[model samples]
Target: MGCCVSLFSRKPRLEKDHWQHTQNRRSSSAKGASALSGGGGSSGFTEFTLAELKAATNNFSSDNIVSESGEKAPNVVYEGRLQNRRWIAVKKFTKMAWPDPKQFAEEANEVGKLRHKRLANLIGYCCDGDERLLVAEFMPNETLAKHLFHWENQTPEWAMRLRVAFYIAEALDYCSNEGRPLYHDLNAYRVLFDENGDPRLSCFGLMKNSRDGKSYSTNLAYTPPEYLRNGRVTPESVAFSFGTVLLDLLSGKHIPPSHALDMIRGKNILLLMDSHLEGNFLIEEATVVLGLASQCLQYEPRERPKTKDLVSTLAPLQNKPDVPSHVMLGIPKQEETPPTPQHPLSPMGDACSRMDLTAIHQILVMTHYKDDEGTNELSFQEWTQQMRDMLDARKRGDLAFRDKDFKSAIDCYSQFIDVGTMISPTVHARRSLCYLMCDQPDAALRDAMQAQCVYPDWSTAFYMQAVALAKLDMHKDAADMLNEATVLEEKKQRGGKGP
Candidate 1:
């Protein structure tokens, strides 16, 4: 008789899992840090005194607190204007194990050296006795969550949403490359819009993890699977968290990866799209984004895509280009509020139809466009061939545009347009967006007008034209264009032929 295979007779030899190895590496690194004399063992970093920080923050008064959560926790953040009248965010940490002033200074110095365009640059740090604080460049705009999750203003356009995702990925990639392999608590709140309306990742993420026993304020549903399993994070863990942010952009809600993965695999992604994105977002792009998110959310940490890959993949899907971070983040207008859209006509739709000619002319003058050779009318078969060529050219443009290669997109889209076989409104609109991104508002307006001429009743064409008109300060023309587009859209919906 063959030896009976006993159930649970012997346990398999244990192999160190990915998280275990990561933890080991982290432990060794910490030991290495501890061995240094302090400074995180380097120098050249500004060290602010406790008294200086207190004065800057008005003695840590409640009035200066800037954290939206309104929590009086040990880790509190304050908005302070420094001596030179430069605004800075001051973070006061409640006491923990960082007692060695030299060691704390050293760590802060090492982290402070981390600088990237996407990061809110770290200005300095303070570690005076029991008091520990960090100072960073102040971001005028609020957190990404306030814009994407709960905005009082207009929701970010599909293109801007895509851009934000790409920006964060690039920021994470920068951190990993700079030797700070792990970003603690990567989330929407950590991304802020600067004065120029560009998104900047909070450099405060470079600080050591909280020692005061506080954890993430967000729901665990969005946390990486590895973090839940081992109570630790790796670079891959940050990627997993980023995947959740993508989900938020796509669905406008916090959803568990397990459920989201199920929907993705089932080809039911349309059900998960944000309602606000209806008619604006493309199914193909959404699928690609979802695919990336799924890869990032993979169960095996090793299987997750790297930050480099994430950046490369997302660069092409950016629809609208150069949208100010303030606009995308819904930064409150200081004075005049723009006109709100009537029902059935979205704000963007209205804005586009109204036309911003002054803005358009300003943007137009900024870019140089190739002459429009003009398209010739074609027979059905010839049109089909032209369409194929147009699509191929547009495909190249889309990829270039996603990568923020505006010049290339313009060239490719121009080729498609010059061929002039297909009357594809979307292609025209896409090229217009590219033109706008490249600061060629004239080119943008031209494309928008061409789109309208091709598809007389399409709202997008009118909207694009209106944007150009409004930008050019042709308010009357812009308003009229917008009214025409709205009326046309309403007429179309009512099953009429034309306005």
Candidate 2:
């Protein structure tokens, strides 16, 4: 059975403006636009600015690195929270990987058109100057490699393994039907489990990493024979890679295809099974999967089974449809921790400390820009056309924020900030809360930091930071920030001077 909920249940309906190139850059080709505009509307694609990404990932800090190769990998993957507060996997490619920015954008936009529950969908991309990055939905529950080979608690159950095999087959078949059949480096590492523990095929494999078409990144022994000959990947090459994955699931070890084929021929099926399983798996089912793997491993490309055939063969093997994947995989279901009680304070402080974003929004709307009055003290003579325009943008942002139109508020606030004519801690804090309401804690945190920079002793700035940090799951930091905000508020009430 499929996972309990659709992965796209919260998919963002991004604005058309977000897909446009920045004013400084030349327009992309019509083909790129056409491909991005597919699927009726811009429901699944976004073009992120490099600054937004840097803020999300804390400037690509090594602590956020998630790739198996870590920082040593030419292409590094970092876990980040978008301004919308959505967790994402950002794959930053090497500068030389895609020299032609247009080509990279077009390829990414094409891949972004595809949306499947069994696949970790590509949500956005960045092509700023010489930088190339692809953003995908993050899978919280580790990769198949970790679960299969280096599992800490227990090896994956046979039924779950069968489910993983079937789910990934469906993912590949879906991609094939959608006109994307060539998957690069299809391996256990590319198979990731979502929050529900259901396996998803990584969309990163659909795009060639290098312009030279160097597809496989793993050891040469695991690569398809044809790719060795021509340095190219066809639809059949993907099938060959799938065979290796099946071998991985069956044996729980990275066995060479040639060695696996020899063992199969010798009827050493029992010997090939993962000893960790302790013969718990169904022999009949294992035999059927083994047969399919051998067919996929056939030396001749034409001899390998199609993706559809793999799906059909694995469909009957599913035995546990009612049970959730997490239960079978021994992964704990994600549960929200209860809030810790604290001594009460003023309504705004209490709301901020508790992360009651709606309550905070109400307070912000009521207060309006009154806190900003003294900060932006512009003389009549100094009020230039540019200054008026910037103030007008802030006014527009405030109106939208009051109306609960967060996306419009963000856009207006961004315009106001870009003008750089005046500094308003209130504006930054309000925009920061708007970002929090929109589920983008990272952007909220950055805005909160900007507010702190503008008004170091402001309690609202620290409170907003606390809320953002709490949203990002940094509870310890959030508590510390909240405490600091409380101290700042108490000092302000007592008529104490700024620190």
Candidate 3:
């Protein structure tokens, strides 16, 4: 992000809708704060008071620890209140119980930043310095991993399983290039559910930011071979993890402890899926998902599509009206296919066309999204080649792009076209600020022109243009640019009509 007078980095983040507290929510920890300075969020992080967390988790009692379902490892949870005075569950994190410190922080960061309609919110954090604990908004319901694999005693509608799968994919997209959530750890039991039967991701034990700055993906079972071999996790590796989760989602079963061994033997993938699905969903969609999964789970990370592309592939299903689980599995439904597609995104292969666009767009926004500092995955990648290169570079040095070195800075900005475009708008808009501070209107106006040309649709660009032109004493051009921008916005709102 370039230095701008506005202080707001236009990172295209999902705001108030996701992080803004729903009510006067209060946590045992006072987790929801009105404001905190220098922290990442807009007003900084809102922590759940320990009091609210304890109440939400029933005083963090052992009885709340539900027995682990199926062959999955055990999990314990507690319900508590939040700052809003609402109830939420808190998942306790054991000290270095899973991964490394850096790895652990990355996980929490991803969970902290991930915000989806279907995904839960990360309200606060607790770390005794060395030990870390993660607290989410808490969904009354458990996890899909639980209802499907652990609690076979219960019957999850087949339609619901697919819906769960779809929502999870959206979650992945949110955490992936679309939402640019750096946090995504696909360990077996991380995803949670709410009373509304919606799913939220839990367990940031291994998530990492996808931005070039941090640690990446985890999960040895789902990790791509390319990543593991060379220490690089590509979007392909994530696809592989999605495939592994899909198998569980479809089969409605957990990965039997022994199954990991069987996976090594190449047992039929379908056999691993939750037996509950019983081949009930659309074979075409299933095939695509599974096939994509297979590609993702491939020993090679290059074989899979980025999650953004994958979501585009799955968007079409949103159009299909909700059908009974039986109907989904060819059981029967009065209304199956809707008259038209319900989702606004392209249904079919549109994702492939825009994969790069989505990926870059997502990456750009991540720098500005608010998240917990302890869990910031700004620099964790399992084994991506490029990621490794970046990490190696970081270990070797620090931010050499200081503004003092004008030529070096410009060169640095130029090669990073996408990031440059994003920063240029801010730098350009603050042209006057630059001139006032450094007496460098020449440099300021140059950047302003570039920013305006690069992101013209963005209002900041026009305003910056005004500053630059006015500084150059070309007041007419400056005014004309602002007026032109106004017309563009008005025309856009009126569907291309303006006086």
Candidate 4:
């Protein structure tokens, strides 16, 4: 690990000329990452003058060898330096794509500098010509994916997978729901394991702050259906991915799509278990993981659990040796996840928003005393009426935002934000999400930025900038923004997102 860089404290900002020095970056960052990957060298953020990177990364050698040798290799690639030495694995980008590079860079910048037993640190980078790079401490183990796919060596024990699954979920939940844009990608490939077999998320190229990453490297099979269908990417996707990963851990195989569908139907779900586990795991754990996975994969995005909820669910998985062996072959043979228990919709709340299963569930819960299990429990007519009312609310909010109704949008969200005793970060994120929908980047940027500011050191705000930048076609800027966010976030907590 490395020492922390003081971002909030104040440091000389980089000069523009250094970043714009080259039209070509591959020629510069080829040497530095390895030297920057560990501690006792470049502990904090290391900004390299263009010339330094030119000497280190061999000018961005395509053969730079980002991944390690053998079946277990690292997923991210980078070229940077540490403590004035070269040959580090962390990387800095040239002409970063994120909308708010400062935000991400600020965060990731810190990551390179700190050192801790549980937390990894940032080391160094290449600074030249519209590109900024950071060298972060690298973990030795391969990601959870290696075990999940297990092409050669023995697969990770089922209990270990379950333990990892729970821990990873909690980590991601805290990162996302704690009001930061720090969304974990659940890139099985990025969850590294070492000689000691400890699990860690290799976030050099992940856990980015983005407006939307539904299209990013997520496993399609694990992604929430809403994100897959709509351009809008929400936290529900994160929950969905978490649930899927949990199920996969138990099953000892990627859940097959067909089997998943059966689970939804409430069919023979026990058959979904991984035979390799050979009854080594418990039915209770398998049932719970499966149940949660089904909930997360709800056909409607709204019905899924929030990352925070996943965090609550995950706390129980750690240190459980008897954790079950479940595997995802696909949708379960059972019934699809059931509907959400909605509270009655507030008058000021979104209307069509209620049409989203999640919204509907919220409305039902708010309005009704108990869940109506019978078909006649709540007349189809009454449910339709409630839905219509929510739709109207949604329409009104949309109309206002469309009409430049910032106040109305804010008002609508405010109502939801203050709803009941629990104000989910999703609501806040969604409120800001409105700005993007309304074509107001500055506003959205502010809201997103505020999320970071209020929750300083979280990834969500950084993500807002990343997505805003990406939405504006600033891929390089988006990437850079993610970098800053990670750096800042890394400093506050390792394997944890900021609050």
Candidate 5:
């Protein structure tokens, strides 16, 4: 037997056979549990539950939709936070996009195995019933398209643009080396900025957006010539798409490949450069990139350079290696702000009055919704299915709150509120803080108002409102609310009912 055969057995078992066996085992186990455990190189990959995902995205609310095309896209990507406080981008596929759940899970697992600093790595996936979703590390700053094409404040600097090209090329090369050469719709949108504003290739592009194999969603002008004829994606096709992205970086607009080639042919390189750069870019670097773009956009796929070649050609052009991407790109550096000093008050009152989110979060975690214990007052006769569900949701929210899982707490508390059973000001107050901790001051404000509606004289309600207002930058309103809360607390302590 050749190297392909197993040495221990006369019966031949190829490498593909071994892989298939492992995949079968994984698939079988996945069917038994709500999620598949990580195996092989995919140790970090998780098979998330539908309930967990629904809770993360607030039941796939449109408000959480983060896709470039928004709700109009067949597959919508939502920004979400897991119970562990990790932020994720959830791509929810349309119904029956992957009819075979096994295929979906396998594809997800294969893609999840790839992790690199250059990639927005796949974290997990959910294949519950007819719903199919892929979760990846959230890229906070936005896509290259947003910065390049629809820039509001300032366009990306030359150094930042070069960094994007070099980084994405390295990403493509890394993926190709790892045996995942084909990337669907490799465009500017597929390049996203992480917290540090570094460009990372979205792993979502590795898997076909749907099982139907309709890969390219961009305009036909930007698509590779081979794909138009053969209706399939190949490694060369991805290279051609990368060429279009390079043109986007150079021209600062979507220029068709054919049109851009004519400009390159006519020695209009200067005109092709982004006018926003104002001749700041080095001539030698621009010419090198233009030459590469011309070669990549060649009509014959065989004439185009490989992913590694692209990386080699672009690597030396990077001049700002020491500078952080956020600094080069003009994005504010993400840093923790020191808490401001505040006057001393009751523990809970002081935390909220100071608008110290960390202190308030700690208070909520310690309180464990004790104040809401007797507030609902559900009797045995009134304990129907809806009431049980409402209470169960509140119980779940309390547990999550105690664990400091604010996202889950928000979801469970929202469920309880939606049930519209017996109201509890404490539940609203707790959820208000959950929203605050989650950085949703508007939602926190709404919940605080709801708490005030339930119990107008509740000091916690006023305090939460104050905190939310302070977060929203309405400092005057926040100070007034804080003073009102102090008065209410004093009245309640002095054996007088608060107004």
Candidate 6:
């Protein structure tokens, strides 16, 4: 790992020229995506009338409300189901005093166009006569905070928690590219999980702070130092909020950034990790996350790592393979007794469901295929030598992957794959990720697709394909691939056939 960059060091902000280039690229992407997908709504958004929203939310019944309560709350969220039976979340700004409805809708439409796998994409908006509302894809799995702090059921596994960090960071990084827009009041609550059990940043985060009001929901301790001192938020302020979220993930509890910084400086982050993760977590990975979190919590806004840096850092820490949302979130599956099935539950099933790629690798490394008999046909010496060779190559790959030496890791994994000692989905997945890091999207996509073909039930393969596709700017296709991955994941997690 590289030495931590000092947070106090000021970095140049994205200049106007950069913004112009970004906008041009965005326009090209939209055109390309629409042309390639043959769909007009590549943005995956819509516009709604107030009456339609009212109908979807049962006339804004109290039972449908999802956020804080108040007769005239400044902003409130409601859970709604559109006429098409698609579940959605509606954010109504009661106090937002936009003078022109056309201007408000235009601004809302601009936000809607900003889409990414990690964002809860804006589905539509309603700006009718004094009513201003934005509708988003409803996340049934609820907020990250609910699982982290208020879980009445099983807590999320270490892998799921780590994935959440990656998802949010990716979302923010995409936002930065779109226009370094201010993501006000970013916290665990703003991060929600989709039906596929993937984490998504709420679209509301992109709303300009002026519209959301100056008051923050969290304590001053958690607010960025700039916001605390100047009562103003900049792009860096959003980064600071991201840092607080990182702290929350590391500690498994909310700790003020100042106090968290004290722990980080003292190298006592191990003491802050969630007690539940102690036995199940990897020390090395946790240390990396803690270090990154500490950097994010730096006092000077200039010192903080930007969303792009966070995305780069987190993309690797998301080590585990993709697990179905239902299993990761601990959502109960519907009971069903299966008749005779072709693909019975294998040892790999449970490990893969939990995203325990390490365990899967160990199992694969240990596995020795027999010649159609339940017997070790090889001589003891020959078997031992073969095992040693396989283990050595796998170890090399693992080390290279951990060190972020994607080229070396790809070489090592390729050697193992060529030998064909044992069938392992994780090797394919890992190599695919390495290919992505090496900017070989075609190879990455190929490997990911091959992995999926080899293990149709594995969600990780689909996720890899999604990443590769996104890199290629095939956003619509990537989304479709992700949905497929999520479906297969959900089925496998529920102990059903991959449909």
| Model 5 RMSD vs true structure | 19.0
Kindly provide the TM-score of model 6 when superposed on the true structure, using C-alpha atoms.
Answer: 0.59
**lDDT by residue for model 4 (21-85), tens:** 21122122212222322222322234555555555557667666455324322133644443333
Q: Report clashes for each candidate as comma-separated counts.
A: 37, 5, 70, 133, 0, 1
The per-residue C-alpha lDDT of model 3 at residue 375 equals 22
lDDT of 6 by residue, 418-465 (tens): 665444456677787778667787677767755543444456666666
Lowest-scoring 10 consecutive residues by lDDT in candidate 3? Answer: 36-45
Root-mean-square deviation of every model:
23.5, 14.6, 17.2, 20.1, 19.0, 17.2
TM-scores of the models, in the given order? 0.56, 0.61, 0.48, 0.49, 0.61, 0.59
- When 3 and 4 are scored with TM-score, the better candidate is 4
**Model 6 residue 420 lDDT score:** 54
Deviation from native of the Cα of residue 60 in model 3, angstroms: 3.5
Q: Pick by TM-score: which candidate is best?
A: 5
Number of colliding residue pairs in model 5: 0
Model 3 alpha-carbon miss at residue 26, Å: 14
lDDT for each candidate structure: 0.64, 0.77, 0.44, 0.47, 0.76, 0.65
Tens-place lDDT digits, model 2, residues 144-194: 998988889999999999999999999999899978998999999999998
After the best TM-score superposition of candidate 2, give how far the Cα of residue 485 lies from its true spot, in angstroms: 35
Q: What is the descending lDDT order?
A: 2, 5, 6, 1, 4, 3
What's the lDDT of the predicted structure labeled candidate 1? Answer: 0.64
Best candidate according to lDDT: 2
Candidate with the larger TM-score of 2 and 4: 2
Minimum summed lDDT over a 10-residue window in model 2 is located at 1-10
The TM-score measured for candidate 4 stands at: 0.49
Off by over 4 Å in 1: 1-44, 70-74, 211-217, 328-499
After aligning candidate 2 to the native by TM-score, how far in Å is the CA of 142 from where it should be?
0.7
Superposed model 3: Cα runs more than 4 Å off = 1-44, 48-59, 66-77, 83-85, 95-113, 128-131, 152-154, 178-184, 203-234, 255-279, 318-499
Candidate achieving higher lDDT, 3 or 5: 5
